[model samples]
Target: MGRRVIALKPLSKENVTSFYQWLNDPEVIRYSLSLFQKLNTEADIDFWYKGVLRDTKTLSLGIYVDEEFVGYAGISSLSSVNKSGEYYIFIGNKDFWSKGVGTEVTRQIIEIAFVEKELERLMLTVSVPNQGGVKAYKKAGFKEEGRLRNAALRDGEFHDKIIMSILKSEYKLS
Candidate 1:
């Protein structure tokens, strides 16, 4: 089979429903920071989308696979002076899990950050237990910087998080 078309596109109001459904899905947000947020309404998602649009330092995009919205990825807290930002991603569609989609998304984001944006550094935090995320980040050339002890609380228990980062100097453009 041929590889599915995957692209990061500007998010729109049309995606509010999908965002709401994914945010409300326990399985979807199990390993996501969305678990701590209270975006319980489509309006809330819409508001978030607007905020991202207005935020000059933030760039968020919907992850589309073959013309369907499957997930989202973004970079926030961008600092031009420091040339760094915090990277984030989530594949809300369960069917897409374990399909190498995350790795592809990560690589695309890296290219945008390093080449287009000319950012020198990008970092991310992943729950220690989210092996899939950790592996995907590593596969995209992010190296572990350190761990925050008992940082994330999932299912009433605290879990550690690993901080990983990649620098423009280290990223070899393909």
Candidate 2:
């Protein structure tokens, strides 16, 4: 089989419902930093939409496959002084998991961060237990930089967070 095609579009109101559903799905949010919190209402989603997602410093996008919304990806915490940003992605549509969606999305977002946003470096933190995520980030050229020991509490215990990053000089579009 050939690799699947994926696209990223600016996040918008049209994808709010899908975003809300994904945010609440435990399986989808398992590895997310906000796994402990709950977005219990449309208003909560709206608050995030207006506050963080719409913030001028962040670049959020809806992930689409065959024109269907499958997930979301973006670069946040952009720093003008340092030319750096934090990256994030999640395939909310569980059907797409382990199907190279994450890798493709990572590549696309890296491209945007480097070529479009002119960022010098991009970084992210992933739960240590999320092997698939670690693998995908590695495939996208991110190198493990360090670990945030017991930084996240999940399922009644603490989980280490692995810090990964890629500098603009290291990224090469394939």
Candidate 3:
């Protein structure tokens, strides 16, 4: 499969409902740990939809392949005490998994974080088992900064969270 990379468009009400439906599935929520775990309710999803449309520190993008919405990428947390934006993304459609859509979406998100947002840094945490996510983070110029001890509990076990970061000054992002 090939790759399709582009900017995130504003989410419309028409598309928002579909996004909510996609996120309700356990499979879609598995790796979206960086964001809140659940967005199943209409009020929660609608409120979130309003937030995503005009967030200053965080920019949201809709990901598409062959004109179909497959995922989303966000650079957010500008108001965080950490003084840097955090990256979050999800490719809700399992059919697009392992096909390189994530890497492309993330690269653009990182690029915008540095160049457009003028953020000092970008960071994200991934579940221990999300190897593909870790690899994509690395490919987008992030380094394995550290791991959060027993950060996430899934199924019957605790999973350490992998923390990755990229510095704006260190890269040609800006």
Candidate 4:
């Protein structure tokens, strides 16, 4: 199957409601801790939207398949260091998981980080149990760095966060 590349675009008030609706579903929240507990109210969503509009360090994108917004993604500097950036994406429409769209999306964003941004390295942190995401990252050329143990408690158990990184020289994505 050929991978359809979706260009990443800016997020705004227009689809903020759709994004909010996507997050409200429990299934969508299952693996997303960063946004799972955030901005439930309209006012709060407005505030978050304002923040996104002002931020220059992070680049966010909506992931569409067949011309529909099925997910979202972002690449942000992990620290003030500027040498490395972290990434996050969700194919929240559950029905689309395991269908290769997520992998293609990862490839697109990682390519931007390497080619356009001139970033030295790309990073990502994942809960140990999110194997599908990890596999996608590995396929896109990420190498496991290490794990932060007992990082967060979810569903009555302590899960470690797997930290992975990919250097520009190491990525054979093309």
Which residue segments of model 2 deviate by more than 4 Å? 1-3
Candidate lDDT scores, in order, read: 0.87, 0.85, 0.76, 0.77
Mind giving the per-residue lDDT tens digits that candidate 4 earns over 38-78? 65777776677677667788887877777667777878764
Clashing pairs in 2: none
Candidate 2, position 28, lDDT:
79
Candidate 2, residues 27-70: lDDT per residue as tens digits? Answer: 77777757316775778877776665558888888899888899
Question: Model 4 off-target regions past 4 Å?
Answer: 1-5, 78-81
Question: Which one wins by lDDT: 1 or 4?
Answer: 1
Candidate 1 residue-wise lDDT at 40: 68
Q: Tens digit of lDDT per residue, candidate 1, span 27-128?
A: 788888743256767777778766766777788899999999998898999899999999999898999899888988999999999999899999999999
TM per candidate:
0.93, 0.92, 0.83, 0.87
Candidates 2 and 4 compared: the better one by lDDT is 2
Candidate 1 residues lying further than 4 Å off, grouped into runs, are 34-37
Error of 2 at 50 (Å): 2.8
Stronger candidate by TM-score (1 vs 2): 1
For candidate 4, which ten residues in a row score worst on lDDT?
Answer: 4-13
Question: What is the Å distance of residue 161 in model 4 from its true position?
Answer: 0.6
Query: Candidate 3 — which residues are off by over 4 angstroms?
Result: 1-7, 34-36, 79-83, 172-174
lDDT string, candidate 3, 1-174, tens digits: 554544466655566776677768877787675354667787887888787786776667788777788777787677445658889887878888998778777877777777877777888888878888887778778888899998887665788998889998766643
